[model samples]
Target: MRLDQMSGAKLEQDGSSWQAYAEQPLTFQFSFGDLQTNQDKIAVFVRSVENGQPEAWVQASDGEYQLTLAQPGHYTFEFKARDQAFNYSPVTAVDVTAIPVPAMISVPLLGEVEVRIFQLLVLFGSLAIFGFGYVSFEIVQHRRRIVAAVERGYNPYISGEPVRRVDMFFGRHDLLRRIVSTLHNNSIMIHGERRIGKTTLLYQLANALQEVEDEEFWFVSVYIDLEGTTEEEFFHLLMDEIAQTVRELPELAPEQIEILNGLLNLHLAENQYTDREFNRDLRQIIHILEEYGAVQHRGCQVRLILLMDEMDTLSRFNHLIQQQLRRIFMRDFAATLGAVVAGIEISKEWERVESPWFNLFNEIAMAPFSTDEAIQLLTEPVRGYYMFEPDALDFIVEHSDGRPYRLQQYALEAVNQMLHHKRRVITLADVLVAHELIQLSGQQPKGSWGEDAARGELGVPQTPAPAT
Candidate 1:
């Protein structure tokens, strides 16, 4: 089959591009000629000039196709003709480019027209939803298809689920990198309320450490959920988990694993198996780990990171436990043994008992997602399957305010709303509807200003985080 006409043909493979309006839909028409009349169908591929990811593509017999590429970036297109005999012929191979030309395309700010307009609207104090289209059935069906496609393609946004899998987790790249770097040399206190993604951040720390490169010390992470855990339980769990973590670490000799296990079991076999014995041997184990890294395989040294999550449980532990932790982190083997403590108020817990060991950690204040990171958290989970209109995405970011749980939950609801309206793309109006529904369901955040803030609220103050 041969092509009839290509839209935006000024787009050239030589890096030249056609300046198409952002959000403009490009259409191409194809027809079967006498020579290719026996063709079963023709396949079309569209790719972004920036990342080479497709904007849209489909196999069709002979017809017109359209896709609204709202992202303002360089894009390329290709067309292929496949015959009934399965023979393929090229119509265009990376031939055309579409570049979006918007008034504020050069703005350092993110999102698109919606964000720009919303900023302006905020200044004018008129953020009310002036007009919105009625939800259409086609939009709902389209949105459902996208939601289902997302579930099949990548990890779907599950409410209350910590992003254990790396792919499901989005954004926080810079934060994760920073935490990992800090963990290499020092321990950190992750300060944030529960459900703000502290657990996932800790998991991501483990995930990043799992791919440790040679020469860098391999941090054997022992994740300890300290919520409701007593001091005795902590001792038992820490020893049990060290055995488990050894197995998960990289480049451990059979002797190395046995040595670690034997060390832990030997301490447990103490006549009393008391906290005193647990503390002493745990330090010995930390020293052994440090030595292993310095001597064994020319890979990561035996550094270990204790992911002490829900650190609030320390409130229930006695000063002995605190003293033990202090000596362990500060005196025993600070160089090789790192810890990441996650909790609502790390300082508050430390204040319950004055401990200089708390001073050893560089505090990492876990704040809400930033705008750009929020965009990735919103889009990456559903990449390639569906898209959020600039305004819709901005609206969600504004309402959710970088709290990952709210963002995912609201985005999921918006998808449901889109599916209910048979829409493939989420719009500002859709976000508003979802916002209202969430508010009605009693899930809206407390302390939010009423309708004025709800409609066109601008710059609601976020909770101030303590300085690190």
Candidate 2:
């Protein structure tokens, strides 16, 4: 007979989902459906998909079976029948889902858990709030101090922007002194690396000459920045300035003013002169100024000191512009047309690609400050404020290595740190902190922090960042 005809197991009861407060048990029943032979055993096997195999299997015949699952989930029960001849009925599987016990539970004594959790949250939240407030208060106080410093004529250390006032400028007395004496003798060249205060010195020189213009007027200083101008623009602008200068100086003789007027009239007028015509007129105007620029300002004749700043900016143009400048500087402009030319690397042998007439200029190479000069620089402008610690001053001077711009940057940042920490006197520690902060913020591409510190880059530390 077929196995189905011999015997079979059945899932006749206990297969459904139910909610229970007490233990819920599952039961199964088997059937020997018209079997011709006797059956030895009947069994049930249970397995779960999510929860894996159930605890037990069973063997019985024509009897009820029960299973208690370990957890609430869906399960499958396989019911089978076996005969004494080792024949078995086919497995009949039925799925059942057990309903979980109600979610509500009660504990008689949780013992102040809610109160303790509230207390912990309050304590941490208070700390976080206090930390934020303290930092904010510190920042506000810092800003107020800086504002007060500014209000009281606190001269800040400036980088890149040249100091226009003589009172604000520092550490260039001797350089100015030499240039003062040299202006009457020959053409002047003020050259240094970028951001080295070349422009500021030129400004101060003009101020010096004007200040003494009453007693022994040597030259009326004329400053022109030739950055971002085309060759044609430079020539026209040069001539335009010459005309304006002649008109402004009442001390120049009528003949002297007329000479400049005749040559530069082509430019000041709407006359459409080509680049070559402008150059030709420029040469003539400058040649006349070379003869007559020496004027009676205070009994003695004064040369018009032509201060050309950022002259290297012109070298990127065509050779015609460069040649015009060379002729003007090398020949004559304003009698002893004193030329105080300032540009980056104009003194270096390698950067002389523009012209050989650089040799005509006596080099007044811009340099960093000495220790005494550096101290004066730090203290002189903002004298009445809190005294600087000698060690702090020494540290700044040493680290900055006398670079004017770097020195100012270091001092200003250190002062800022003093304000941040509510410090009365700037200390060496504050200096170090300021140095680190500024170094971390530096954006220069070509140099590293270590290299800058060694070379005296402004506001960079002589040491390293600290480890947490």
Candidate 3:
């Protein structure tokens, strides 16, 4: 008997069993050299003593052999080689064993129930269709409904339309570092010009916080436009979001959910809620989140991150709301959670409120993109959409001053105009034409127009560039 081209074989001394690590097919090479002279047959089978089970015997050719393990266990492989003359060799025993790993033994009853109710139902329903051979037909019908609903209800901003993030030359690393480190310190303020991508940065930061994964930290990102929102509406929106998130999470307990909902509603209903309601709610949310950090053996340390965008429009409470928020932010919940509040010149505007919390917040301003960053943003689009001349991007970047909002706006408009005109290349002339058309329509102001005045006329905030 000879073994040829043997690979991936594991051997251990002082043990009857040999081990190989695999969950799939197992193959090996074995040959009888003189078998060419006579007809022969060989049988291979794996017998398990612990289970007292034997696999179906497999026939082997003279040159090579293959076998597969259907289950994991300790087994002895037997080989019987017989020649055409009815000669047989003694049974050759090869021991095989599969290794196992430790797993969590306890399952919480509530979680088990949820899994059975949601996951098992969906899985078993799909399995039944598959078993009946109607899987493809059912999938087609279900997929059509999904596609139709998505087409009907699609809204870019609400749906989180994909925005290709461009790595700016003066990266946001320093600002991000300060914001993350401030998780230990308290709240931080993001005050900048309009369209400077404050909301974008906030979303990006939320993504970054996923790295922390420590249970102690919970990140709840809330974007309240404050447009057409009353104090009741705002409170309800916040509460609804928090409640739904808690309910959806499988890891949290029903008691914790009840505690959180009770605390939030208590503060809201008692009219004990003042401007300090935001502060008080924030404190409670953080406290509840901290409880998620503690397990029996290990305490997961995490930060509760609150990212709020468009702080200026939260004026439903009259001018008094702003003043109350400023005071509450300055005093009440300064030591608890990390917050990023975004608005245009908010710190300056809030200073009149005389709230020291306004003073305590670590203020960072976002500057407009540098010329290079603007050019990169412009050029990066060319590979995806080829309506523009290579030189057109440079021209757009020059005119836009590396402002992301304006860059995208101008680029999108320019491409539309070029396609409308049936032109092959978008030139500087095309951008100039679009500019004239946009200016003529009073969509954008002409030369020397005041940014704030233009923003007010357009009903859009002027976002500043991101600060390095």
Candidate with top lDDT is: 1
lDDT-wise, the better of 1 and 2 is 1
lDDT of 1 by residue, 58-151 (tens): 6653566565656666556666655556566655543344455535433445544555676685665642432222245556655665555433
lDDT of 3 at 230: 65
Candidate 2 lDDT by residue in tens digits, 1-468 = 112211112222353422222245555554554256643343333333434565454664355555555565666655656555556667665555555544433334643344556566679999999999999997887666545553332324545567776667778888898888877758888788877778888888888877654443456678888888666567677667656765676565677666666764454543354455565665665444445544433365656777888877765667765666666656644344668888885666424654655467788778777898888888765554455899999888888878776676676667666766655578898789767866887831111222232322222112211100
Best by TM-score: 1
TM-score of 2: 0.54
The better-scoring model by lDDT among 1 and 3 is 1
Q: lDDT by residue for model 3 over 277-392, one digit each (tens)?
A: 55556566666666764542145544445676676656325656555555554556444445677878677765654543446567787887777676655554343224457577
Single out the weakest 10-residue window by summed lDDT for candidate 2.
Answer: 459-468
User: How accurate locally, in lDDT, is each candidate?
Assistant: 0.64, 0.61, 0.54
For each candidate in turn, the TM-score is 0.57, 0.54, 0.50
Candidate 3 local accuracy as lDDT? 0.54
Question: Total backbone clashes of model 1?
Answer: 13
